[model samples]
Target chain A: MTPILIALTIGIPWLGAIIVWLMGDRREDLTHWVSILFSIGAAITSVLLLPNASQETALTIPIGGDFGDFTFVADGLGIFLSVIAAVIGSLAVIFSKSYMKGEGSLGRYYAFVLFFIGAMVGLVLSSNLLLIFLFWEITALCSYALISFHNDDPKAVKGGIKALIITSIGGVGLMVGALIVYAYTGSYDINNFLANYSTIPGNILALLAFGFLIAAAAKSAQFPFQTWLPDAMEAPSPISALIHAATMVNAGVYLLARFYPAFKDVPYWSEAVMIVGALSALLAAVMALVSNDLKRVLAYSTVSQLGYMVYAIGTGSVYASQFHLFSHSIFKALLFLSAGAVIHSIGTRNMLEMGGVGKKHPLVKWVFIIGALALAGLPILNGFWSKELILESGLKNGPLWLYIVMVFVAGLTALYTIRCVWLVFFGEPRSDYHAHAIGWEMIAALLPLAGAALVSWLAAGRFSVLLGEKSLPFHAIEPLPYKEMMHEILSLPTLVVMAVITAAILLWVFRKKLEGLINGLKSIRWAAENSFGFEAINNAIVKVTQSTAEALRVTQTGILNWNVFGILASVILLLAILVLGA
Target chain B: MNLPIPLVVLITILCLAGIGLYCLLITRNLIKVVIALQLIVKGAVLAFILAGNMTGQLNLAQSMALTVIVADTIVAVVGLALAVQIRLKTGSLDIKSLSSLKR
Candidate 1:
């Protein structure tokens, strides 16, 4: 029964993808309804699968060959992530009903959305490293397809290709790690490897650890790989909410947390992860603070928040990371969707042109504020609880430098959230832009997430229990009771983060008087806008690849005989190797 | 000198593959290229059968060889159909325009 539910959780959306795509773009209403129903069905099945979670693998399909057994475990981490992917994916599809009402190629949009949800669930559930890689690539492909759904737009196509290329590079890292695991263990089962990884020699293990780190960083848009995500804003807002903010980006954090027990003792691994998280958090916060583009700022903040999760994992606080992942998914989805609502109505994503939007759409304003307050980590919000948990954990276990950077990023988070809100919704109208009526579907999607942003922290006790050591024997996670969790958070580190955040708010309130300080930070602001030179590095690599490809074009004469000769030559070389020893 | 059965079969396989490669290197017509591919695949199919006979898995080897032939036949058919289309469109059997991926 559990295996059947697991199958349904993944299969339902994939089945929906095929059906909806087959339905085509003729009836937009039917397409939207089918997507919502299928996604919701997946959501329900995934949620049902959660209670049956255990240490044992839920299902195994044995092919009895080199590809090995495809195993899926409905453990705490896998179940929760699948739940997040399905639930938030359903909401995004609901939001899209209003957002993508008359967009051409409705089939393409919803098909990719459903496919991505299924792939994400599959990615988390699968314990076989090779199968996980397959699912991982599937998600990346769906993300690329959906990102370029507006294929006629050159910018969207370019952004999609950029995302695909970067994530595929990360996919290479994941493949390398999987291959190494297979090579050493002679099997691809993650649980088996986790128990026996110590038998593998030290350097090979380090290589695998760092390789997985590279995979996680690129997928999560951490540090150097953060540039593609802001450009990925060319995608639809619900896509931004579903793939970027909510589910797919969280895969990276999920990877780190799942493997934390195995990679725990690798020399300098935790420090490296911590530094990557701190750098991403700090850098992205600064970028968010200066961004005029509404969605770009949110994109930057998403990176910043993911950094906190990565930082938590670096601190060996798997529970905090997963908890923060939960909280971040809810509020960030709400934020992106509300931002979508604003963009949908105003017909612009530039915050500079979006002042006084709140007055026209009070519902969007209130919901965005709820999400923003959560993003800003205000008291009584889910973000605050989870973020403080992360911060407290980081302080106790992580290095002083990284702890300090994370705390600073927390303040920076509040400052940018306030600034973004003020720029888009407060003050007098900044530009002469006509606003449209907010859709009922948009409101329906926004309300639940807004409510979740407020109260998701209430599930902290249950969440910890779900991820506890009982279910995940390798990960030493202790369940946190609600009152004690609250008590634990009411400590010096929390006070320090609160003070830093208050100072950030005050800085925003008195911006006019801080002209000197602002001017002093101009260099940093310039660097932030330029993505601190990672964009330049990405461009440099692209330039080299293009030039190299151009230089090698002579080899591709395209004549049939020449191509056949080339293939024959390679075959001959292989034959030579086989005939004569080396 | 009398060769072992495996050695004789191996030499036959090499001769067939070598002829195919030579034809492929010189062929300008798409149909000739398709024929060359078929010859190469026939050699591969023979090699598989020989390998199966040696390994005492004649059934598995023959099944695999049959699968390869089926797929190779489809390829030949597609290649010929494409050649016919190209001939009709361009008024020649030139493979250059069809093969080159360069834009």
Candidate 2:
């Protein structure tokens, strides 16, 4: 049953891709229906499979002799992520129906989205390291294709290429770590590696651990690799929502959480993870505050939110990390889709061109506000509970200094969230762009997510149990009366933190009078806008890698026959060494 | 005390690899590079066959060799296609001409 569900989890979208592709460029309705139904099926199966999965329920299919197994697991962690990928994926597809109506190449759009969904599911479900790498690369490919979906736009193509190049560097980390594990354990089975990894040398273990860290950082857009994501806003807003909120970027956090049990005990790994997350969170938040492009602002916000999840993992709050993942996916998707509706109506992502839109488009206004409130960690919203849990865990388990920094970062999050909302929706219309109302499909996509953002905190206990952290004895430091079971979030400290976050929001809202003081600290503003010069450093590394690849490309010698000969000769030489005396 | 046919095959494979390496090192033409790559693949397949003969593990070697064949074939196909594209687009096959990547 588990294998069947796992297969459905991955296969449904793949099958949908084939069907959508088969329908070709002509049949839009059939393609849309096929994609929608298949995505829904995938989501339902993920939800149903969650209850059956233990920590060790894996399905392995024999690939061939000696090449080892292609495996999938329905673990609590994997199943939880599958639910996010499938659920948010289906909503995006539904939203895309109205958003993509009459746009060029509906068939191709649905095909790639389904392909990406399948790849994401495969990534989370795979229990073989080799298989995981295979799925990981596939998601990168799909992301590239989808981001470049409007292929005529040079900026879109460039954005897609940047995503491909940067994420592939992360892929190198995954592949190297997998190969090292296989070299040590003599099996590609992930469970085998997890069980026997400690028997390997400490230095080698550290190397593997760092390799995965690089992979996660690059994939999740931590610090140096973070620039690619904001540029990726050139993709359609729905794809941005999917990649940023639900699918691609989440792969990084998933990798960290999945392997935390093994690498948690390794010295330096947790600290490095924590520093990377904190720096990214703080840096990206400031960038988000200053960005004028609405989608780019949200893109930076996504990076910042991912940093919070990464920071949670670093502080040993795996449950808090994953719980935030669930909440963040809902609100962020809601935010992106609402932003999409606005962009679609006004034909601009520039917030300066988008003032007073809320007064006209009540649906988008309300939904965007819900998303913003949740993002700001206001009371009764899901983000508040999970984010506070992470901060609490940091205070208890992480250093006090780091906890204080995160708390301040939370305030920055609230400030930017309010600032973004005010710039887009409130005040008078600032530019010539005409504001229009949203359609029913747009409303349909957004309303449920707003509800989810409001209510997902109800599942915090289940999250704690799934992450294996519920047994830890700890104090509930909140003063408000939170329910011990379902409504377990209302506490005094939470209310105080909320008060601080709200205060930050009020300060940013009134910054015009404070402009003199802000200008006095212009260097800090400049560093934040430029990502503290990290962007320049990252660009240098990419440039070096490109030149090196070009230099290596010189070896390819344009002749096809030589390539064949080189392959044959290398094969022969290796055989000679194995079969004959030295 | 036996000199097997496969042992002779193994030595021939090494000789071919050495020749391929010499060609790869000395040649300036991209075409020659492909020929060298093909030679390497041949050497690899020959080695796999020899190993299978020695260990009596025919299936494993064949499967692994099949993957090698797939990779080599892909390189050959894509490399030729790209070469033609570059030649048509830039009107040359010279590796120096490809250096326009610097821009």
What interface Cα RMSD is found for model 2? 6.2
TM-score of candidate 2 on Cα atoms, chains taken together: 0.82
Q: Where does model 1 exceed 4 Å of error?
A: A571-582, B1-20, B27-85, B94-103
lDDT accuracy of residue A36 in candidate 2: 89
lDDT tens readout by residue for model 1, A1-582: 889999999999999999999998988899999999999999999999878989898899997988789999999889999999999999999999999998899998899999999999999999999999999999999888988889999999999999999999889999999999999988999998999999999999999999999999999999879988998999999999999999999888988888898898999999999999999999999999999999999999999999999989999899998998999999999999999999999999888888999899998999999999999998999999999999899889988888888888999999999999999999999899999998899999999999999999999999888889436679888889988997999988899899999999999999999999999999999998898899999999999999999999888877878777788789889999999975
DockQ of 1: 0.63
lDDT tens digits, residues B1-103, model 2? 7788987898889888878877776675666667777887889988997898789999999998999999999998887788788778978776566655445
Task: Report the C-alpha lDDT of model 2 over A426-449, residue by residue, as the tens digit.
Answer: 999988786565667778889889
Across residues B1-103, which tens digit of lDDT does each residue of candidate 1 receive? 8889999999999898999989999988778889888989999999999999999999999999999999999999998998899899988897776754577
Q: With candidate 1 superimposed using the best TM-score fit, by how many Å does residue B50's alpha carbon deviate from the native? A: 6.9
Recovered fraction of real interface contacts per model: 0.78, 0.00
Give the CA lDDT, 0 to 100, for residue A436 in model 1: 95
Q: DockQ of candidate 2?
A: 0.10
